[model samples]
Target: MTESFPTVPLDGAPGMPLIGFGTWLMSGSECYEAVRTALDAGYRHLDTAAIYRNEPEVGRALRDSGVDRDEVFVTTKLPPPRADQADQVLAGSLDALGVDAVDLWLVHWPPGGARPDVWERFVAAREAGRARAIGVSNYSLEQVDELTGATGVTPQVNQVSWAPPLYDPAVEAGHRDRGVVLEGYSPFKNTDLGDPVLREVADAHGVTPAQVVLRWHVEHGVVVIPKSATPERIRANLAIDGFSLSDDEVARIDGLAEV
Candidate 1:
């Protein structure tokens, strides 16, 4: 069920899959089965976090899916409390995920003054080969700049909440200026699929509103991770490559940001 996907190159690491599967608000057997479903539906990039408390389930699913270890791009985060103890935190994550190294390891959040110190450790983790790439999430542009200034290393990726309605040119510019990839979470959560614009675009493309939104993110050069427990929706989200939205349609959807 593997499908070809565009990859964003890392400065000195492996390329990341553009479309990733997210695991959040899912746990135990539910999380296990959902991970299996996502893998079966052609998703090669998987996003999880220590705070999510489902790494074992996700790890089990990875082993059970029969997908090659190198073929799949796995990303996990370091909890805020362990930000200063990145080595120990990553060791715990590795044990939880049952892997020696993760493709990407991110600092879940910035904890004020300690952020710089934590970021330095994350950089050390990358240098030590515990993570192929290092980055941060829920970080502001200024914070990102500060980290780079303090450590002399820009993050490979900056993950944030993004959707048609949450589009911000400033954020895009910030990432672009520093060669950081913009990864979007909650791609469909904040969006209303029933909105006239989404529905109209979806109808014209003969696809679902969810697909329209996912396609918009893909076309905009943003990496999107959409979480879903439904099997049909998981497959539908990947079918976005079949349709293309015109510039006018992209703008129309962009207008939703102000609505």
Candidate 2:
């Protein structure tokens, strides 16, 4: 069921699912249970961060869920402040997750917004096999280019706060042109689900506006990680694969962007 989910091919790793389960503010049992439910709901991709301080819970859920580690796409991040201790911090993350390496590792944010030095450490992790792929979060296109210029290694992904209201075709094009996969977070928190356009589209498809928003991301090839603790919603988020939006529907949602 997971193998057929829409995915974006990565250079040296398994294809990343277009839709994933994001664990940001969640922690403790809440985080673990939510992840278990997500995996059971057919979410093969899971996104967590060191700063989120829930890798242990996420790992526990993964192990307890009985999903083959190789079958699940797991991602974690490095806090910018840990740039000087990248090796140690990553070691800790690996130990906590009980994995030899993460499918993807990201610099949580740019250190001073231009630390190719940190990116270098990320490259080292990948080369050393501690990370299958390397990337950055909360980065601008210029910053992404700066790192690439400095290290000669382009980050495989860039995660940012993305939603229909925050959409920009030029930005998406920039990532595409540079060969960076754009991953979005907070799909619901960042969107106004009550918007008329979303409602109209949802009504037509017999799905909620939230599902339409998620499907919208996949339509553009942008990876989306929607976080939810509710069991029903966890399953519902992954249900987006059953239907697709028309080009007209996509354009209508794109028009919701303040950009």
Candidate 3:
């Protein structure tokens, strides 16, 4: 099918959209409406998790959106400390989402000392076709390497809390070297929209700070999933294409990084 959303090719699997709708803090009917609004607003990627306790609602939204299943990319995460139960957890996620298989599946966090076993289970689930693409979240550079080393299966993507203060060039570069894509969650860093710097950029681009931040993520080749429940904001978020930031503008935001 012709792609309805801007896509970033996964290292192994098919392409994923540069921006995805996140359902982290939303729940109940709220999540359903938010996700439905997002889909209506042209968002083709949806990020949810088993622990979020809202998969059923999200699934309902997807079904109600009138969009074809093949056109949308649905991503969900495995609950923490469930290395041994990866298969079962994924099964439940699929059942709740009312999908035969997820487009991408992620480990919410590295299982610390249990990472090796957890990774094994993750690989098994992927191999079983329960998850089309498998990756990790909140994993440091060291942990990413460890998982890849243990399983000999590189992650297709690594979702992390990436913002100006927390962006790590070294880690990003390492993942790139290993052919892993970096997906940024919480791309806004809870920054106020009224912030002067972001506002300035927004004004320059005739867009909002949220757009500037999301655009920055795209410019840097990061896949971003930002959560919002407001219809206007959801529409505004997907309207990030068609603008480009200059090298200096990109650098200015990078300088805002806190060590």
Candidate 1's clash total is 0
Winning candidate number (TM-score): 2
TM-score of each: 0.96, 0.98, 0.95
Off by over 4 Å in 1: 1-3
lDDT of 2 by residue, 1-259 (tens): 2584888999988889898899989999999999999988889999998889999999999999998998899999998887889999999999989899999999998888769888888999999999999999999999998998998999999999999999999999999999999999889998999999999999999999999999999999999999999999999999987799999999999999995
- lDDT per residue for candidate 1 within 160-184, as digits (tens), equals 9999889888889879989889999
List where candidate 2 sits over 4 angstroms from the true fold.
1-4
Model 2 clashes, total count? 0
**Ten-residue region with minimum lDDT total, candidate 3:** 1-10
Off by over 4 Å in 3: none
lDDT score for candidate 3 against the true structure: 0.84
- Candidate 1 has an lDDT of 0.88
The weakest ten consecutive residues by lDDT in model 2 span 1-10
Better of 1 and 2 by TM-score: 2
What is the lDDT for 160 in model 2? 95
**Model 2 TM-score, all chains together:** 0.98
